[model samples]
Target: MRSLLVAVCLVLALHCGEAAVSCNTVAEDLYPCVSYVAQGGYVPATCCTGIRALNTQAQTAVDRQSVCRCIKSAIGGLSLTPNNINNALSLPAKCGVNLPYRISPSTNCDSIN
Candidate 1:
């Protein structure tokens, strides 16, 4: 029984979803696909799809800036390095936080910081 359970767990882990990556994971994982696109300096179909997913997912989040920052930091570390993607991205130009996108700290998040 123990061996059967272990085998089943291994199979499940190995055969997980092969579908396109989601933004949440991308945000969490720095959207490795986007990093690949950014590194390539060209937005391919996969990157566009991921971008759309990112925008849609951002709409669902209450704190969008933090998420963007998380994604930015992740993508910045990628070989392509984060550049211009933020400017062209669907993320707001400014948020309460003083994100890398903005020049100064936002008055909106002054209290939180």
Candidate 2:
């Protein structure tokens, strides 16, 4: 569906060199959170699962920076409100995933590593 398209686009768009994790994988993992991030409803178990999976995969500094860039790109593509942006930023915490850097478009992905 839409997620698949997003994944494909992300894979083609992200040119952050090679990493264990792909942008397509990143999009897939975070796709489930879109609803909760946009609408601010009950957090879905599937979303949290994806969040945890992403956290586990992004172990190295390079991987983490790639993930951060992917997230920022994804968020930039979305027409989210300020509240929705807040939700997206807080999503990892809600899902029990403590990311080293904040997931905002303003985040400096290059500085992560």
> Mind giving the per-residue lDDT tens digits that candidate 2 earns over 26-82?
777877776787678788998899889988998899998888877777676655678
Candidate 1 C-alpha RMSD relative to the actual structure: 12.6
lDDT of 1 by residue, 11-101 (tens): 3333322224333444433232433333344444554554455445544333344444434343333333244344334233221122333
Q: What is the TM-score (0 to 1) of candidate 1? A: 0.37
Task: In model 2, state the lDDT of residue 110.
Answer: 87
Per-model TM-score, in order, reads: 0.37, 0.82
Clashing residue pairs, backbone N/CA/C < 3 A, model 1: 26-31, 39-80
- Which residue segments of model 1 deviate by more than 4 Å? 1-24, 27-42, 60-63, 76-113
Query: How high is the CA lDDT of each candidate model?
Result: 0.36, 0.77
Model 1 misses residue 6 by how many Å?
28
TM-score of 2: 0.82
